[model samples]
Target: MSDSLFLGIDSGATTSKIAAVRDDGSVFPSELLQRPTGSEGGPEGVIRAWMRAIDEYMAEHGIKWSQIAGVGLAVPGPRRSYGVLDSGPNLPDSFNGWNVEQDLISALKQASGRMLPLALGNDGNMGGVAEAHHAIGDQRAGVVMLAPGSGLGGAYIDPTGMCLDGDHLAGMEVGHMAAPLHLLDVPALTCGCGRTWGCFEMYTALAGLPDLLNLALPRYPDHVLADPSLGKKERVLKLRGLAQDGDALALELFDLQAKAMGLLVGQLAMAVDPACFVIGGGLIDPDATTEAFRSRYLGGIESAALAYLWPTQRETLRIVPASLGEQSQAIGAAHVARLTVKAGSSVQPFSSTSR
Candidate 1:
């Protein structure tokens, strides 16, 4: 078992990342591999791109399928079952009815000529698992993770580092959760989830940035970001650079983001009473400028959240950035695969109809 390796794949709409982990839960970031998702080709093409990334990684590192103990794949969107997705908002319509887990398994067998144990999990839940056990290493207290990327996603990990998926397996759809819109003093905006108003993601995620900027741009006509030629997404992405340069409008946007995040965390804290809350995803960058902005933003969140909590809760609650950074999802998926194998579940030779 010392030499055994578990493979973790984080399959996102834009990119697919792969990493191998040892039995002891260690992984080399240098060995991580990725490829464009190639969603234009549909489900089969996306899976093939992922498989090619794995194949190239193994060949480059001299790894063989015989030494691999298990595999885990993390995917986005709501699940109808273990490996079947109900719909993928960021993915092409062709993938809506696909059983991604079974397809990946068949592709693996064809590529590696082995039926390895595999586990499929939601990307948010897998990130929580990694943060709870490997990154934060707090096995005694429950952990909650809120990842703000193109959209917001979350997961709850019990004290034992197991993710709680609930009866429907859609338990942690935090993005669609109703928020306290009145707290922000802004008009309620509809979310992609079809909520008429007040979805948390509508205030905090990248998808929501355009609306946020729209509200701000009216007052800052002279600002460089206010140029009509820059698309909404481009303007949103450029806000960070402006914030880095101490631009007032950009800083204000981040401040609003912090307050919204605080409100979301406060809501979760009251409901779940988790010991710690970890913030991850694209918004939480490791670069110096981003780190400085994140530090200030976190301070604002803490202040806002503290106002909503009792003294005891305030003293005990912890909010921190994700330690594993970009590698969290992949490392977490590998960790889940290892756990599945340890539970004595048979994942190899899986049937298309099976979980």
Candidate 2:
């Protein structure tokens, strides 16, 4: 038994996942770990809690920490240059100045009594890397991954096998980009960060959709309060059901979401004509292939690209849902860990600060 098992962990707002893989990219369920992430406690507590979960999994498998080659952690926030997390709204403010990347490596080394290099990056970046490696296989050139869920996250990989970790480690912060608001007539909605209108989270995110639905609620009061499955799916299924039931309001909501997403795609296409646009998240239904995210969003962008900071090119864009679904980031973390260790380097965690 080689003690070269690679590990990857995904730290999200609601839940955290850890996975282990062999050097050949073969993953084993016996090596995977899942647990809740206590985001409210802030970054340090969350990391500690997750570390406990990982410890439990390792113990159950009778696997010593020393057996691990390296660990890769994908965090929900941006990467910091000096091992710190710049900002994460869902986390407590105590996480400020937390150097997530360095801290994890230190903890692992301390626990194992061995220096296991840790690799870190933004959750989105690792998700893109993971999805591309899993889905596209060897083609690493220019690929874009769009995550549409609680918030929007975008990751871009260039032709030279270089992942965009940024100079300050804040690469691919597209969720912060100002996506359009096709449904809102009001002055642009502000983000929790207190920015003015047109923020990305305010447009297509899970948080944004309910507010958008509320705007249409007055017209279709029946569905707002009466739908049995309303709150569970964040009213997404309700909106879709209503659309199916000929509720004008629901149809309007879906149409609005589609249009806004389309516009976003168009804008993204101009910046990098990605080989494939991998869409992943809770909202994207893998079964709903006919939705044509690229066509719809690119169409919107084609109409509105001139107004954009960067013009778009629609001819070469292909929009597709990520095949890995919710597990992309975790899988990618494993891949990254294995690659880093094989290269004879320590893995870089997302940040050095606790948050």
Candidate 3:
């Protein structure tokens, strides 16, 4: 393996992505390729799919296993630490109560024919690393990232562009944090974490949007989503479409949710006081017609976040969209691989035997 090349892999429930990153944080032209995650295929199926994709990516780019200095894998988490993924809301149930770390390491060794140093970490934490080190430039600053997808996730990066949660391995599970009690009802939205009501995700996260709408349906009898026949996907899509079209109900939801988000961000700011906040995920990546609505949503948060801040604190805080687009996780995984190999052992070891 070329010493300059590092391999990074991100395995999500629906897709598996791989990338080759250089030591200086730049990725190869053939940076990313995606493959099916094979969630229903069982463990063997998932492992084989990852192996095939990795092998193909390496061969297509003439990258040898020998040239690779390290390998990093980012997966969904909430285990004791990296490599110990007992279960995640995003992954298949088959992965729960299994030895994900060792199994993946052994499988990777068998597939690649090498015992390269490996680092495994939470995808959200790695995404923070990518955002800190690669995205938004090389400057060292305190950056907080909020990815609103299936659920909300957060990662904090210190001024040196290093992950703030590295000491713990798994990044902060911000979505599970409680929301304002006043905004919650007894039968509030059901969150992915299995909690009903009060979770910050109830008002955010694409997956949680439908549940939020379900609660709001009763208040707007004439709203399209009020129809009992609409499924979750239909409810969410209709809401999104209406919001994009400047529908009053949808716009009001954004305006109202902004206050809740402002409270959360304000609370976080009171604790960490980060330099900037970067927001991302499919929720923010609207197409041409929806750009205006996207701006409104972001604007709402920006304005609301200031509610709790004084003039001085609000003056310096900045929030923006992800500059790296969808490649943040892949690139961050490679960077973690490079850093792990350099350190000889990761602070969050992928295998229990590592220390």
Q: Pick the candidate with the highest lDDT.
A: 1
List TM-scores for all candidates, in order.
0.88, 0.75, 0.86
RMSD of 2: 5.2
- lDDT per residue for candidate 2 within 51-84, as digits (tens), equals 8978987888777766787787787664345456
TM-score of 1: 0.88
How close is each model in CA RMSD to the real structure?
2.8, 5.2, 3.2
Error of 2 at 12 (Å): 3.1
The regions of model 1 sitting more than 4 angstroms off are 38-42, 109-114, 218-222, 226-230, 348-355
lDDT of each: 0.81, 0.66, 0.72
Q: Rank the candidates by TM-score, best first.
A: 1, 3, 2
Ranking by lDDT: 1, 3, 2
Clashing pairs in 1: none
Q: Which one wins by lDDT: 1 or 2?
A: 1
* Candidate 1, number of clashes: 0
